[model samples]
Target chain A: MDDRPGAPRQNASEEIEALITLMAKLPGLGPRSARRAVLHLVKKRALLMTPLADAMHNVAASARECLVCGNISGAEVCHICRNEKRATGEICVVEDVADLWAMERAQVFGGRYHVLGGTLSALDSIGPEDLRIPKLVQRVADEGVSEVILALGATVDGQTTAHYIADALEGTGARLTSLAQGVPIGGELDYLDDGTITAALRARRSF
Target chain B: MDDRPGAPRQNASEEIEALITLMAKLPGLGPRSARRAVLHLVKKRALLMTPLADAMHNVAASARECLVCGNISGAEVCHICRNEKRATGEICVVEDVADLWAMERAQVFGGRYHVLGGTLSALDSIGPEDLRIPKLVQRVADEGVSEVILALGATVDGQTTAHYIADALEGTGARLTSLAQGVPIGGELDYLDDGTITAALRARRSF
Candidate 1:
């Protein structure tokens, strides 16, 4: 019941507790799971903990957001932003660096990317100035981009951000498009959301 | 589908991927959650990642299994094993160090512990020799322990290990006892399994 900051949680050692608290701060992890992870790591200190710490420290010291695209990169600009072959007059806009990486994992996109960092959210008070919207607009104008594909989430914030960007780039001669919203590959109708089912029906194509 | 060791994983950087791969090796984490955790860590390198890495490295170097009881501790012998006040003529045996910590969190037992490291499993080729069984026996004999408590799991292997230890400790004049099986605190009867209900009924206490 002690709610004071840094209160001891009956952990064995201060070092272990500190490590567990930090691990708990990570996304998708809570105190119990963090403790479990720290125990697992400690049990395999030589085989896993040391190497993981070394790798995390190296990344913490070296990883930087790409200066141009806002993607996480070791260099000032990411390889995708620097690669000339990817400058095919098409640019994909994603809400987060994770999304950009997901797109890359698909290996279907050969164009450049602009990471929005996060979508606009009125509830959260996040506006155009809060995100990389200005930078994205500047990139579209300067890179001779012909198409700006919004590969954002299907959430309300994502749709609003896409609309805002489309409006901002009006008359810039760059075709504004968003990713088609339909049932995902391997998706089942039973598990699909109502919005998705409606969108799939609206955007249906000839088989 | 490429199962090659250290195969590239389409990550933005090798350092990031290495950290994620190590994280994925944790007990409850998967590749997706590891990537999410790494991304969250990278985003807060200054606030969380660097300190977590430092803590992990320190624990990796300093945290050693207690020479006597196999409990993880900063020193060669854990604080619990060396403490003079906790010699309550009782020793609780647990399957893992996590179980030891859980017992400590309960703060009810004023005794020592013997971490088994793992239960005896014929399927996994693990025997009592692989655990700290001989050490427990030596401690019981040298320390004049009056009672040995088994706070192990309810599973088949846990029962088998407890029975094996009980058989080994016979004729030593020490009382052998295992943790009681019953409905957990705040447990609903509807969710109770048949075996647990049966055990609770057999071990019923007068109201």
Candidate 2:
């Protein structure tokens, strides 16, 4: 009778409660919404549901972080790192793999990617070691990367991280450039359309 | 160099590419957007990334469908259906379990629910068996039901399903009612805000 599942409980199955709890934890989905999503998935089991479950299961089982770029992968090296044709002298530096994928979808960037994971934030006490900065530097040297394109956020911390990376790679002989200032502050590259990303890449400025 | 992974024979370690591909398949996410999401999750590994991964893994392993009402439940039956207090001699019959959960969020519907799975769509060749209509009928008889409230969509298919059920239950002593006609055509109950749902429930009409 008590709507609260936390109450000394009734005859409910533990698995059902567990499923609801997990669905409730998802972004934009609360306990109520999670219940709805679960219901929808079950009813449409043949079309949308089964495929989604399989995808989730497969991804969950095989997913791992890329050692080189912190990108999601099924194996050790991410696809971007393994691809030979994508190994242009240019390496597009992004704060996240999502941005890298966005670039790839636009089909403009022929080069590889360096996912920084996140920008330096003093408030968050996040430093270079917390991200993939060290690996990025090593990649430039090990891969003969000629240019490091910075497609980071315009936030203060993002700018600060960019400057730090530029300083660290000063003698690496790789041309350091950044996406144009056109990217608004705290504006994630994910929200930008293909044209905007292209323009930003085309009008890159020297760091 | 070639960004495409599943396109041909190659090593399967392309984590970034795999992540991007998987992400691209998410609802409201394309190849480009999935890439961005993966990148962001990787960057915020500690704060956002790790937590999300753990959550996904947990849900992936345990999530399942409820046997009774067809809601997402970790166990055989959903929490709502198991609670004795929820057995208020009234059952709100909805086209989908999502509708049931939406009603729950309003904290107005104290009774149990019957998830029909979907409306009877002739064009789609969806019949009573195709949905959980038979199950709903069985539940009404088994649960000592008083009122069978229909919270179906305003679409033609939804109306057809409602009429079919009403006709089927015509001789039954239980009363048949439906949510007000104010609900828009082809409108999903999930998209409506709480107030609208409350109004619709309060202004319900006889079938």
Candidate 3:
């Protein structure tokens, strides 16, 4: 009974312990996994750990948020914003940089992106001014954007923010569209929630 | 579908791409998780990413394997090897540094450790010389050790290494013991493997 695998230990060196502590604060890693990861990193120093350290150092020194779209980049303007080929007069709005990256991975949207950082939260006292909403409005007018895609989440805050943006861009004369809600790919209708089923039913289309 | 998540994109900056590539190479992480982790790191650069980078740099610069027992530390001799209080006559031999760290977490073993790096693998052509077995033998003879506990796995390679160590230490006058095999706490007999069930039966105690 004394051999619990993940009990905290004070025997590790200060740097290793510190590294594990920081690593455990990451999104999916816990303390036990952090310990295992640190061990792996140290054992493969030449192949992985050192390179990762160098990469992080470089990023910490050079990485910046794009002044135009709020995407992260090494330059003031992100590559997507600077790329002339992607200047298709369309802007996709997302809540965070992770969502922007996810959209990029899909490669479905061939235009630029605007990261709002987070949605407006009344409880948190967040307003449109706190986000990049004003910048987005300005971008729509200045860039002659033809379409504005609101790819926000289905949460209350996300919807509230989407409606607020729609109102703000009312006079900008840009067409606005939000992603459709329904059963996801490979999802079974029987297992779907009532709300999704209703949305899917309402949004039914002809083949 | 043109929406493959991991299709290589030239949009990401070189350093960020490099970091994600290395992170994906970790034992428990994949491309998607690595991308998420990198995005998290970039967003929290001031608090988490900077500190993690510094800690990695420090550990990479100073961490060294213990000359005596193979434990990792900032010093030539690890803290466990240097600690006078833990100089018990017992030595626990393990397959890797992670296992050594796991034992330290248990805090029950008041003895030092010998990390074998890996178990014997005939298919991989791993002989005794590939491990720290020779150093362990020397330590047993020179340190006046009383017992050598084999805290290795019950896998074929683990058993093979344990038996090989035992044969090598036949005349070393140290008591040899392997970890006991039995039903684990909170385990069900129905779900237990045949080998484990047989071992548990053979080692059953009478009330």
- Chain A TM-scores, per candidate, are 0.94, 0.79, 0.93
Give the C-alpha miss distance for residue A109 in model 2, angstroms.
3.6
RMSD of 2: 7.5
lDDT of 3 by residue, B134-182 (tens): 9999999999999999999999999999999999989999999989999
Q: Which DockQ-derived CAPRI band holds candidate 3?
A: medium
Q: Model 1 chain A, poorest ten-residue lDDT window? A: A1-10
Task: Give the per-residue lDDT digits (tens) of candidate 1, residues B76-189.
Answer: 988898888888999999999889988887768989999999999999999989999998999889999999999999999999999999998998889999999999999999
**Residue B201 in candidate 1 has what lDDT?**
98
**TM-score of structure candidate 3:** 0.91
Error of 3 at B177 (Å): 0.9
Q: Which candidate is the best by lDDT?
A: 3
- Candidate number with the higher lDDT (2 or 3): 3
| Chain B TM-scores across candidates | 0.94, 0.79, 0.94
- Which digits, one per residue and each the tens of the lDDT, describe model 2 over residues B1-207? 434544453323444445555545444455544544554444454555444444444454555667878766556677887789888988888876556656765577778888787888878888788888888888888888899999888778888988999988877789998876456677799898776688678878899
Q: Which is the leading candidate under TM-score?
A: 1
Residue lDDT tens for model 2, A77-196: 777778888888998888875566556655677887888878999999999899888988899999899999998877789889999999989999999998765566678999987766
Ranking by lDDT: 3, 1, 2
The best-first sequence of candidates by DockQ reads: 1, 3, 2
For residues A97-159, write the lDDT of model 3, one tens digit per residue: 888887887768899999999999999999999999999999999999999999999999999
Query: Each candidate: what lDDT?
Result: 0.87, 0.69, 0.89
Q: What TM-score against the true fold does each predicted structure earn?
A: 0.96, 0.64, 0.91
